[model samples]
Target chain A: MDVTNRIERALTEALSQADLAGCPPRLAAAMRSAVFPRGARVRPRLCHSVAAACGDDNPATEAAGAALELMHCASLVHDDLPCFDGADIRRGRPSVHKAFGEPLAVLTGDALIVLAFQTIARVNCAPDRLLKLTQVIGSAVGVPLGIVAGQAWECESEINLAHYHRSKTGALFVAATAAGAASAGADPEPWRMVGEKIGEAYQVADDLRDAAADEDEIGKPVGQDVAHDRPSAVREMGIDGAVYHLKSLVRGAVEAMPPCSNGNELRSLIMSEATRLVPAKLAQSAA
Target chain B: MDVTNRIERALTEALSQADLAGCPPRLAAAMRSAVFPRGARVRPRLCHSVAAACGDDNPATEAAGAALELMHCASLVHDDLPCFDGADIRRGRPSVHKAFGEPLAVLTGDALIVLAFQTIARVNCAPDRLLKLTQVIGSAVGVPLGIVAGQAWECESEINLAHYHRSKTGALFVAATAAGAASAGADPEPWRMVGEKIGEAYQVADDLRDAAADEDEIGKPVGQDVAHDRPSAVREMGIDGAVYHLKSLVRGAVEAMPPCSNGNELRSLIMSEATRLVPAKLAQSAA
Candidate 1:
């Protein structure tokens, strides 16, 4: 099956276990909406692609990839909450909070996160690999250095922009690569650098879009970085400089791919992904 | 260390790693307060006592016990949110949301939930046991049959009262027992009924207290069951019948302990716990 099909199947099966039959109708609908009508689903794609590069067709890898996407979606749901970004639109639709009300939105995010790990736990794998996958994903979503910590940084008076970017965006990207490797029964350490670079590049690209693109063009509210005084590459380095940094990060990502049987294929994958991730204007300029 | 000391130390160590230095003071403070001014810590006590009864003192048990406490604490934080219970006070102090504002309360709950699993991942255990630990806790906290589903039940127009009580309260108790057994490298399935009965007994006790105790005696709001029209034994079965039911449930809990080396000791422990869990007024009447 294609990565998208695998992810869709895994997510659908996993969510079905949520027993929405007994839950509030709106909450169930909101969770379905938050997951389906998917975004680019870049994280899971990156995860499966890396697992494939490692010569793995393991079900664990598929589960890991699906779990990563669930976490990503959960993060987006919470990030759009009024307490955080307060974004009303996401992926060309109303945010979960905007559609379901704040209470259900909160529960949706919480349930998705629980389901993410539960999804991984049910994957048929050797205990060791499953344990490692759990650890990898847990650390990525957790505190002190995880995405939650990354978001918490925003509440601080003087935020470390680099740490914020790395935690908020880079953490999940790193988890995708590391967990993909772990699920394939390979060492996860080497994949970290590759994931970090991609994560940083994606954040930079988001900053560029936030600064330069129209809200309608982006399909969501724009200029949020400036409005919230959030730390952003575009705000810190200027649009042109941020674009330059993104290109450099993508180059670094390609260089960081671990030597493997499919090293060339993985490099090509990263290159193509880099192009897709970079803002169109920035990509055109760089080209 | 004793269970209380061990719990205190474990929670302190876990919260310390949340990178509070970089997080907002209020967020950090709220997380701390949510944990510190501890409730009865009954769940961890039960977990540790069960592990001890099973002849296991591994650090994995400590970690599991600590993780369960963290999950319980996280649930309390979210449960006390304005949208849910709007509880103004807890444990003789301002509830997390009331003290630190809603946003921080929400984030604090999220971070703590993440920390709960992270705490387990860091435990020194065989990978198999670790995998089981994750499954047990995740299952207890996740959808369909977890505490999250229990809370979601309130949002529904009609709830199966048995399922609601089991998910909302019994799930964690089951998790505590199952996790403790898993930590000890024992089969966890047998321990679940023990946990479920204790949980049900505790909930009934809570209902009795809520309906009958003074606010100062309970050290939080009273009459909440009636206020919200929440399902409760006291409301459903009446004060006398509920008291009779609490005794019966406690007796069942004692009878449900799995055949183990410390069977008598564990039975006695449950009996004492049953005494403590039932309110004095109810106990007097039942006696």
Candidate 2:
């Protein structure tokens, strides 16, 4: 099956579990709204690619990829809350909070996080591998350096750009590679660099889009970094410098891929993603 | 070590992991404040008692208990948020949202939930047993019949008392008993009834206290059910009827315990807890 189908199917199965007979209908609806009409599916695709490159497409790997995407979706749901970004539109539709109300939105995000871990736990796999995957994925969404800490950085008076970006955007990407490798019973450590570089590149691309892309092009409001006064590559390094840095990170990601049985396919995936990351006008100008 | 000390130490270790370098100081502080100055620690005690009855003092069991406590704390933190209960105090102090603003409180709850799963994943245990424990614990916090569903029920226009009580309170109790058994490599199924009854009894007791006990006795606001027009045993059944129900449920819990070597010890613990559940004035009045 194709990567998108695998991720979508796994996600559907996982959400179905949460959408049991007794679940509150609104909460279930909100969770679905947050996830469906997918945006990019970058994290899960990376996870699946890494697992495939490791030469194993285990059911556990598919579940792990789905779990990563759910976590991403959960983060986005919470991120759009009034307390945070207060974004009204996501994936070109009303965001979870805007559509579901704040209370259900909060519950939806919480339910999704729980569902993410539950998805991994429900998958039948080697116990050791499941444990490792759970740890890697849990750490990506957790504290000290996880997405939670990344969000908390916004509240702090002083912020470190690298730490903020790493925790906010890079943690899940790191989890994607590591969990994919772990799901395949391989050493996940070697794959972390690839995730980190790709994650960094993605953030830079996001910063560039926020700075230069049209609102219609990104499907969400652009210039949010400026509006929110958030630290970003474009803000710190000028547009040209940020674009140059983004290209370097993409190259670094490709070079960092651990040699595996299906290395070429994975390499091509990363290169193609790089082309899509930068907005077309910026890509042309950089070229 | 005694059960209290064991729970405390495990929680300390878990929190320390989250309080790593580079974590936003306020976020870490908020997380700690949500957890420390602990409440009665009833859930962990129940979990430990069950583990002991099942003849296993495994580290995984301890971790499971701690994870349960963390989940409880996380729920309380979120429950007290402006969008939810909007209470200002918990455990005789300002609640997480009141103490550190709403944004930090949200992140703190999110972080704690992640920490709970991470704690269980980090523990060393038999792979199969760990897997079972993870599923049991994860289900207790997620949707359909978990605490999140319990909270979601409040959002719905209509609410079923049994479903609300089961998801909100009984689910974790069920998890405590089941996870304890699973951690000891025992079948978790037979332990469910004991948890269910105990959880129901506790909720009744809470209703009784809220209706009759003083604010000082509970260390937080009382009469919230009336204030919020929430469904409660006190409102549905009256104080005398609720007290009668509480006693019956406590008796049911004792009778439902699965036979094990340390059965008498667990029985005694349950009896003692029942005594503590009812406020002194209510107990005297009922008698």
Highest-DockQ candidate: 2
For residues A1-287, write the lDDT of model 2, one tens digit per residue: 89899889998898997668778788888888888977788988888888889999799998898899998998899989998889999988999989988888888888889999899988877888988999999989998888989989888888877789899999999999998899989999999999999999999999998899888888899999889877889989999999899889888998888888887777888888887878877988655
lDDT values for all models: 0.82, 0.88
Evaluate fnat for each of the predicted models and list the values in order: 0.51, 0.77
Off by over 4 Å in 2: none
Q: Kindly report the docking quality category of candidate 2.
A: high
Model 1 residue A116 lDDT score: 86
DockQ by candidate, in order:
0.54, 0.81
Candidate 2 global TM-score: 0.98
What is the C-alpha lDDT profile of model 1 across B2-64, one tens digit per residue? 778888888888888764444545566778899986678788878887887888868888888
